[model samples]
Target chain A: MPGTADEGFYELRLYVAGQTPKSVAAFANLKRICEEHLEGRYQIEIIDLLERPQLAKGDEIIAIPTLVRRLPEPIKKIIGDLSNTEKVLVGLQLKPHH
Target chain B: MQEKDDIQQEITSSMRNYSDIDPAPLEKAPTGIDGFDDITRGGLPRGRPTLVCGSAGCGKTLFGMEFLARGAAEFDEPGVFVAFEETPDELIRNAASVGFDLAALSAQGKLAIEHIYLERSEIEETGEYDLEALFIRLGYAVDQVGAKRIVLDTLEALFAALPNEFILRAELRRLFRWLKQRGLTAVITGERGAGTLTRHGLEEYVSDCVILLDVRMAEQVATRRLRIVKYRGSSHGSNEYPFLIDRGFTVLPITSVGLEHEASDERISTGIAQLDAMLEGKGLYRGSSVLLSGTAGSGKSSIAAHFAQASCARGERCLYFAFEESQQQILRNMRSIGVDLAACLEGGLLAFHNARPTQLGLEMHLALMYKTIRTFRPRMVIVDPISNFMSLGTQIEVRAMFTRLVDYLKTEGITAVFTSLTSGSAIDNLERTETEISSIIDAWLLLRDIETDGERNRAMYILKSRGMAHSNQIREFVLSERGIDLIEVYTGPEGVLTGSARLAREAQTREAQLDRTAQLELTRVRLEHKRHAIEAQVAALHAELAAEAAAFDTALKAEQGRDARFSEDRDRMATQRKKGPFAARQGKGE
Candidate 1:
């Protein structure tokens, strides 16, 4: 609430194992949620455990298609494909438009 | 992952009946370990997982590998070994020491070895994860070899690699269930924990059977032991059995109970004439237990050697167990007593088993006896001084061991003789035999040192003979250059006399008899002299009387001649003279 619109960019990472359909859908849903929530002030990184499986434990991921937010204050994790826009917006701490 | 999911679905659907609560009897596959099959009644439970846990170097991995190898080689059951700690090459090289040519078995498509790398740093359990890779690899290996047995060597490696305990526990349970579903008997090795069976407490997940291996050091010798902690529906040996890993694994159950051995009624000689005479003139019964208890230097071993010699002389095989002396020493000592066992040794009719009591455990000693007996198959056995085995174990343990051994010998119909060294001169205190095995002995001969007249004499008596009448007299026994000589002792009011005392008593009786004979001869000579003097007096008197008569006759004849010359005038004179002599005679008579 204290930072202005141009203060900072959102930080996020999508963890997946290979190119599974769930992982692909999770990436698309997460990107759409980021664009709708932060507009032009967001950055996203994608990790595939099939190639970089070592990074899975760093974010404490237990399931495939997990997204973690590394920003502002306390870190948070959201599992499964981010198809629920309302739940994703709230899980990312973004206010819905009136 | 999808392939694993598909297999899992299929396994779950088909394996719904293998519930944890099922109490039905399980099918077993033989482990092929000697003595193990007997104890387990078969082997491990088939189509179920067994947890083998132990500390490091306690033979966990080796046991698993041996089970797999033996299954492949002997039981004709192919096996898959999923090793987490050792590589395939390492396993192949190490397993060769146990005579398992895994490379050859693999080449035959009967054995499969898979190394599952579980590096904690590299293995990251992210998101929803199962051990899908392991399941797929294991399934592929099992199918590749059509294995009936599987082993996951050291499941602790997976416990270390996996960071989440909850996930690991869940996965282990599923893995065990899946192994059961696959209908393959499996073994999972785990490192022993501080207070629990496994480091990660994997015992809770393994359901069918749990086996524990322990390596304990007793008297600076490491002995490996195996015990079954739990078996679901089988009667297994509950005792900790001593096992040895040599060319193969051998587990020995120390004792078995049954008093059903047959007894023979035939009697055999004891080699000593006096000894056999005391034993109803025949000797001990065949397949009977005989105990010779004596004090030190009382010729117990001498009697034993004589028996051994006699047995060999009869063309029967004999085995002598010498705990105190070496073979050379026993043979040499027996030679001095005229019991020349050298011939029997040369002829292969006699054998000497010499070993120190402390060389191994009491169970191992019994096992050695069994093994030797199986190979030798001797008809006669002599345990020279069984008391020496007291140094090996407690009183109860020694009793139990001897009980089993004596029972085995009896069942084999082998005649056995044991010598026990007693302390002090009083021989009736049989508690010194160190074990309660005296009750089983068919014949007990007690030898004692009788101290009398400043000398110790060897005396032997039959204390008990079960089925025969035996001598009760205490015979003076002597170990001479000839052999054991048991002489009937002269028992007096004082006690039994031997050696110089007996000789002195015999000499005193001889001197008293000689003095009485001399006195009787002197009295007889005097009587003869008196009789001769009386006879001479009588003879002389008779001769004097005859002489007197002759003189009288001569005097009368001269008178008659003078009268005849003067016949005419002298006839009257002769008549007068005759008349005058007659008147003189009459006057004298008046």
Candidate 2:
């Protein structure tokens, strides 16, 4: 992927409760998706609500293992462990083949 | 009250069943609004959510803000105000007008104001949003200030933002329950529905307390009233109370507890001596209300001015409310009658509040009066020509306002005098204002213009003086350059004499008395001459009778002597008869 300085960079946040299996799996899957489809142009942040429960209201988070896309205009939220790579890629608006 | 006790028992017993922790019945938080705490007994239910519903411009937001501000300032309870409609800056500015410096409170860490903007079309709700975000924000704000009071102004904005009504209802219920569980007194304001307590029917869920504020416009006058719709575990005033948002939210409950005001047997002068004399040689009770009713030019204002002046003379603060005249005009007129209010005004013992009845609604006028009384703390209050207020409100509203005013004055042990203007000749007919308010007044003085012989005279009479012996005589008084001088009872053959007629009758009586005195003096001289002539004639007759008696006695003596001489001549021959006869003749002569 030929990425411009700002056009192709992705910012994603994974919100979860501690080191739960679902939260761990969701973080790993998000990292893999970003590396395969748009490496070197993507940034990933993991947030454990157990440590910062006060931040749950900022993104309107109720359930754990939620992925939120913050950059590139319109925000989107998806709830799951991100086990299905194709579904995760589709939700993030990436090519399924990646 | 029973319900409250039962709730307390239930709470205490239930706590005993649970853990070792004791749960007592919830106490109330004072609102700090004037007369509001009295009506609410204590105030809003503590650790519970209260729903305040009102239509547009009915002062619901202000009420909620006042509750929070007062709670923070007076109760030492820090508060958090979450506005769903107005921005925090706007709210701060708005609150500043009512003398509440929200910004300062926030800076002191005693109050926290948060604005949550929710646009209905900008958002999409996907699944299972339980308002935890809102809860977290509120909790964060509360923790930041350690707030004990919370206010959510206009909750309908949140309901409008959400798409699903079921979810909104459930979420709102949970929100109220959560607030109650958090043990903070929360005031939730909402828009009033057409025929329901709130547009969202929130009253059904937030059942701890519900208050309704209504602003009604009648005859182009707007009056704001507040009523407590329901308080689950407390007994509260159920009647609608007039409330105003002047410097702050104040609810004035019109109904007094009862007729159990402290009695002040002390009497204060009515300013007119004759009028006071008509009131059983005294004035009015210190805490009583005096109603002075009269027709135009009957000197009602003069009497009121005199009363005010007298009150000032006693070194008591007097508040004079002039509805018909300006302050300058009243002062000028009163000065002309030798009632100089300027000295009192300068001495700070008297305050003249001049207001046009048409300028504000009746309740507004009442609120202003109450506010002034509260600020001035006057010992005496005078309303000149209270009948002029009749033009501003209905009879019922006017009566209610007057009743409340009188009751408040009585409660404060302040004397009050109200003047009213009637229509016809004051003596012939009682004005509608007088008849209606006479019962509530401690003393009712009617000033009438008695038209006799094409001349009008002013007459004053006490219609009623409660708890005192008052004269039943109508005293005709004249307003002169000195003061109001109540003339003595002057009744010609026609009727009571007033004004020039009283003066004329007084002169006539003086003339009649003088003329009768002169006539009696001439009659006394004639009777003295007749007595002297009769005494001379009787003395002459007594001298004539005495002369006649003396002459007859001399003649009888001579006869006895001759007979004795003859007897003696006979006795000379008879030897010694002459000596006895001569002694009898000498005794008869002596």
Candidate 3:
């Protein structure tokens, strides 16, 4: 693995339409996964699409809760409340797929 | 847009008339589509969701997009297009093909197009979720334009995105209700399923109205049809109408027209003055469907050209549909007959539509015609050799198309002149006039080809003309460098004669008349000779008698002179004749 200076840096955006329970769960689950995977190198930004609904169109968001990886080299999106940490790890590329 | 303004006004006004039939009818949001409003009695139910389902490539998306575009542009109601199958750019480009300026509409704040793309690979169903963000986007788009109409083109994409059909169906139901509560007229499209109206049965959700678009192949030709599956709280035309997406969605309703069009009493010439004289000294009534049917090369097109020329001469726009010939060919042929159609073409008073009927389906041809007629705004339309369409479809389909065309032209108050070709070798041999169109046409002019005396000639006669007096006499239809002329045909014991045979027959009659006069002159000379000879004989008899009497008198004078000189000689006998003085006085007294 070619590890550069910002290789461990993580920039994540979490899109939620208002304060729904699933969005909160998704946020909590995503934060726990990132803390366990690489705690000190991650940055999380939360966006409420209800107050600014037009923002959802900018990132191709449709589900209630979505996590978009804006960091590293490739972009990835994981929708719904991230209850399963294994799947979230796989979606975020913290671990390979089964 | 300007081309459709007057026609839409006509449709909506008629729609108002239908809604007025009841004290209070359900209010409708007019789609402003050409014949679609006429079929829906007004339009889809207002402020309610309608389901539009069709198979792949069947124009369901176009229908929805058009609904939104028309509502936003024509009805003054803004719209939001929620596209699931295509992106906003794709939607705009596809709409441009139909002449709808969606991007301009969006810029004018009259439209909003949003693309909802959810990739199944990226979407992870980790926990419970609802499509609330979708609602937010929809609401944002709607509020952006304050739209009254909305279209969710192919919401079936949600099934692929989400593994739960049950949740999608529930969300769709809720979505429709939300749309209804927002008082937005919504159109949600879906793909066709086997034995189902839609893949997920969206009909169960949007219950206000349901439309089914079908594209089926009939004998290797693809035809598109639209049927109103159901309309709640309203009655809609149930027939499957053939539609075409030429410049826009034109649903050709086969037979919904009534016979309530006001008959115009104005008259126009048929361009040939002699033919006009034969037609009750007037011509075809304005806005009447006039038919000129004849065999090939029997001057049908020539006469049609004449009619077109006359219409253009009166400063009316004419649209000529030549199914059998190219425009240049018609122009050239008409020029040979001195019908100056080239001038009319240059004057912008004439337009030509030349296409083989087999090049496209009948519906496509009719749609192109509708689009052209709308744009050109002609006062008169000439379909030269309308019989060429008979080869394109079955008699019934052709009749349906013809009926629709005739009805449309009549409704537009444009005079329609149709030239048809009879198929028989001899026009007189035709068993009957065209069984397909004779019933609907108001005036029928039959052209015939007469072959006699080793020469071929043309003739024309009126078969039928309603609401006016038309000449039934068959006149020899002649085309010369001076244009068409209806010469008085010779109809004697030799049957109807034309061409040089008529001239020969007329000359023969004149020769026979001269022979009869010459015979009468000879008989009068013989009678004069007999009278003069009899008079001379009588005079001779009188002369003979005078001579005899004179001889007798001379003999008596001789006897008296012989008596006077020979009275010196006859004095002897005249001495007795001297005594005849007393005797003569006595004889005189006797």
RMSD of each: 11.0, 9.0, 7.6
Worst 10 residues of 3 chain B by lDDT: B14-23
Q: Write the per-residue lDDT of candidate 2 for residues B1-590, one digit (tens) a residue.
A: 66435534543443344332225665899888787888889999888888888889999899889998988898899999998889899999999999999999999999998777665543433333345456766888888899999999877887787666776788787888789888999999989775566677666567677788889886677889898876766789998888888899888766754577899989888777777777777778899998888888999999988889899999999999988888999889989999999999999999988988877788878878887898899999999878878777677877777888888889999898998888874443355685457778888888887787788778888888899888888887788899988767677685766666677788989999999999999899888887877787788888888888888889889989988987775656345435466655555454
Per-residue lDDT tens digits of candidate 1, residues B315-369? 9999998988999998899899888999999999999999887777777677667
Top-scoring candidate (DockQ): 3
lDDT of 3 at B176: 83
Residue B187 miss distance in model 3 (angstroms) = 1.7
In model 1 chain B, the worst 10-residue window by lDDT is B121-130
Task: Kindly list the per-residue Cα lDDT of model 3 for residues B1-590, writing each as its tens digit.
Answer: 55235433533443444342324467899988777888899988888888888899999899988999999989999999998879889999999999999999999999999889878877666666777888889999999899999999879898998876666777877798799889999889989876567777676676567888989786566888899877767888988888888777888666637677778999899888987887788988889999988877898899889989999999999999999899999999899989889999999999999998777777767767877787899989999877777767887888878888888888888899998878647444243346788898999888888998898899999998898777879999788988988898999997999999999999999999999999999999999999999999999999999999989987997776644553244444446557665664454343
Each prediction's fraction of true contacts recovered: 0.01, 0.10, 0.78
The DockQ assigned to candidate 1 is 0.05
Provide the lDDT at B444 for model 2: 87
RMSD of 3: 7.6
Q: Candidate 2: which stretches are off by over 4 Å? A: A1-98, B1-24, B164-167, B358-368, B389-405, B425-431, B508-590
Q: What is the TM-score of chain A alone in each candidate?
A: 0.85, 0.86, 0.88
The deviation in Å at residue B106 for candidate 3 is 2.1
The 0-to-1 C-alpha lDDT of every candidate, in the order given, reads: 0.78, 0.79, 0.83
